[model samples]
Target: MSDDSNAAGAVEHREVVVIGGGQAGLSMSWHLTARGIDHVVLERDTLAHEWRDSRWDNFTLVTPNWQCVLPGYPYSGTDPDGFMSRAEVYDWVRAYADMFGPPVREHVEVVSVTQSHGGGFDLETTAGPLRADQVVVAVGGYHVPTIPRFAEKLPHGIEQLHSAEYRNADALPDGGVLVVGTGQSGAQIAEDLHLEGRAVHLATGDAPRVARFYRGRDCVAWLQDMGHYDIPIQQQPGGLGKRENTNHYVTGRGGGRDIDLRRFATEGMSLYGRMVDIVDGTAVFEPTLTRSLDAADAVAESIKDSIDVHIARLGIDAPVEARYRPVWRPEREITELDLRAADIATVIWSVGFRTDYRWLRVGVFDGAGHPCHHRGVTDIAGLYFLGLPWLHTWGSGRFAAIARDAEHLGERIAAGAREKAAA
Candidate 1:
């Protein structure tokens, strides 16, 4: 811990330190305390501020309430069918932190965690410095919005911002709105806007199979009931084994947790296949592919139901039986939104988000701008990472999946601490 920095003098020392105060950071803090380890959590803001601040007003956990619990605590709430709202989840996280009374140094921004001469770390923060024998970086992946470059060429009046910044469709410019990307955020936003009586156009890139709930039942309950939550990741077989580490896929960054895009279509949302170019505020789609995508949605839904069946047979739970729902596709004679024909006020880009680790001057990041690690262990001794998407297992990085990684990493940290103390 450093008392003063940039004064030509600073005190620095700590046995262990965890960077971030979200689920992973809070999880690690609990485990460290369980082992009687002295550590502190350095948070850039109050706990779960991102959940409280960034999420849209109507956003709900795609994973049900049963899956929202953290280690050393259970989610005690009355809403079983009621998907947790953003505020509800944030409150749960804060309560969990307060329960164990983890020492959190809030509002202190960590600039970097450079390796010191002694091989530990010179933790440069806005407030002084902190030296640690071990450090766990739990900064999650949803920090920055990943915006496509093509959007830059659009006219100035056509407003656009990523999903992280979008609160709801009320912020959009008046007219039929054009929503690009068909992943979780895009689909949800398109659905919400269409329901509000706006003429919405969804530009889908690639449509993936999404379950209304995992396996015809609530996905989270199945994970816990079948021990998917506790399954030893090394035992995953076949495609499951291949996808044990989830960072390989380039599809919708948010999968398994978004509303069914097909649902939006069934509910009267206009959908387009692809955006070729924006000509005077009009987005033109490829005619052939545009015609084929609507029919393709049926195949996608079938594939999703198949996965649900498989997941249910894994002994997770009985499969859910529901009415067959169809995908939302744009008609050839669909009504086009003329931003030029009318007033265009705002554009909410429900595209996706990315991780911004540039501030942390560390050597562990890969060329793709992602942290390089094996099971959350970095090559830099004493430096660990957590809550990364698919860090070591299929579920490694998802909110419903992080506890497994947290437990394994916690054991590793605790054993290492014991070894160092014995020395």
Candidate 2:
């Protein structure tokens, strides 16, 4: 509520400070504004930068458009079941911000956040120093791209890049491309390359795959009806550990379809087990290709089985569909791959990203550096986290459920403010 000058520079203060400007931060801003909380959203880059820059050019949201809902702004497009492309997603987020006009300061990065001696939070930002009574770290967990240390051992001639840096098949060099990882990004990028007639050598992992459509509707629709998305992380099979689980690999491209690695193998895309190391210009892999593939298929079928049960229990007149059978399997254990012999000109590491929170000089985090919170509220009275996967429910980190999480945090923040005023 005040901008004052200090020895270092000018200090702008507010009742609440929301870090990050993505859907999560914006949603939080919406709720805070609704509750008459004075706050500023600090973003390191432009609004919705991830959708505009980090995602691949051909990337489409894995979830349908209907799930892209903010606090007050819902997907108003005609095709609710269709997926939004990278550009469309960026535009939609921008539109949401424009609609609400949240007090978002774009291009302002927070360098550090710590407790101020005066019973509040102090923030050191790129623009200037700021202080707030409460802070909401809406930044999602994924920050730094994770690549194995063995990458340096690979030949310098081979072009190496993380999945985030990948744009398209044409952007890569001539000859084959080795994609290491079978997560959602890896699978989709592999399919993109394969569609472009690029020879792809995929290093598979244990990431599961789900059918895009089952029975008479999209699998997402069926899951939504079964209240799968409403399940809280605490009630999940693996409990909070489910947050580390790799997302089921499926594509919304070309109007959504199942991504069967076995089908890809049958189409001459070489698939191998997890890449262990790169030694002497050769990539070593585990001999568990069959096991990895089978595991993925098993997960896909398990999801289908759940859907069947849900249908039968509801007595819904859904059309019966045949179960999935393996169309192809690896003939032998191909454990080693010579980069030179395979003519792999590029190596795309689609492994995943790690959360970076070194700047947050707070004691609220666990030994693993993960923030300890009940929902978004931390043990520290005014410190909080938002937009993290499985923070409360399966949809906590996603657009489908961020509004609810933000609303909850907003109420908590408002209550805290009222209590302070009373005291």
Candidate 3:
């Protein structure tokens, strides 16, 4: 890479530029380097910063360690089925970068990416300007944490934060904790607090749940054997709509297990339906607590049913397992919750995140602001996206399948560079 001073500012030039230095970016870099492509990776923060900082103290990968496959560096840990903790995850990614040195610029933020009139792309960054013949946006969606608008009306004395900001039960103010949303993060975090003996009130959403283990192996192992993870997004049951589906809540903490909100309810963790609004200093919820719980349980059983079919079809010798049954049910609809009366001092919003592509001034986005791409290859020449959920397959956004996606993108990028050179 080289830099030249122009009228606007110092302009660094590269054949290809990659944004974000997480696993996605690093994986892309790995492929690019192997193909002898010259590129620079610009990271807004330190490499693997998300794993190091965003997760809670007790967080672990829902998927087993064996799934962590970068471009070339696969997980070599002894226990393939065991999950890696937050610190271990960070170290793993960092070790990948160290093993194969990528031309990564840490703390250099790419403020904007736009098409250049002279061909290629122009990027405005904290360091200055950059020109690239091709660009790979390795940043996965979920740029901004989403909280309900009515959260502002909550009592000021009650501390509020996004699940991303939550570390542990001790970090929160003493009193009952209200956890909103039942996605993987919310469910696990709620379990984290409940195990710590903190007063926990969980507000559930429409997210599904899955059993951690079934028969004699992890559910994930069964799914993998059944070729569930290998299905392309286009061939998925819901097709592209599957991308919007919330992940089933499960946990890898303490040797991996299922997250049963119903069990939590029986154990004194208050369960309510989705929080709709805060009115008159009171929290209003839909009378869908029972519905949500049933839906989650139903999904979990559906997974087990699929497993049973797979086992029977192959005539495998897996041990027979009993289907899950709801252990507890709501006696009555509890639609209103008074924060003060319930002694709920902390509200953690685990409602998920929103995509922020405001910095991208390209016309490759659709009406929904999602990038218009076919397996990460956008319509616009030399522009691409990587590491999006279901971008090509169920594993597209995850560690298990990123290597394949990155390898494909690397081939596309290299071919594009060759075409440009031939021209």
TM-score of each: 0.82, 0.98, 0.98
lDDT of 2 by residue, 1-423 (tens): 764633345577788999999999999999998988889999999999999899898999889999888999989999999999999999999999999899999999999999999877999999888889999998898999999999999987999999999999888999999999999999999999999999999999989999999998999888888888889888899997888999899999999999998899889899999999999999999998999989988898998999999988989999999998899988898989999998999999999998899999989888777888988899888998999989898888778789889988999999989987888
Stretches off by above 4 angstroms in model 3 are: 2-10
282-333: candidate 1 lDDT, tens digit per residue: 5566553344454445544564555566665665555555544554544563
Model 2 earns a TM-score of 0.98
Candidates ranked by lDDT: 3, 2, 1
Find the 10 residues in a row with the least total lDDT in model 1. Answer: 244-253
How well does candidate 3 score on lDDT at residue 14?
Answer: 90
Candidate 2 — which pairs collide? none
Model 3, 130-223: lDDT tens per residue?
A: 8999999998988899999999999879999999999989888899999999999999999999999999998899999999999999998988
Q: Model 1's lDDT to the true fold?
A: 0.68
The lowest-lDDT stretch of 10 consecutive residues in candidate 3 is 1-10
Clashing pairs in 1: 1-13, 2-11, 173-345, 173-346, 265-328
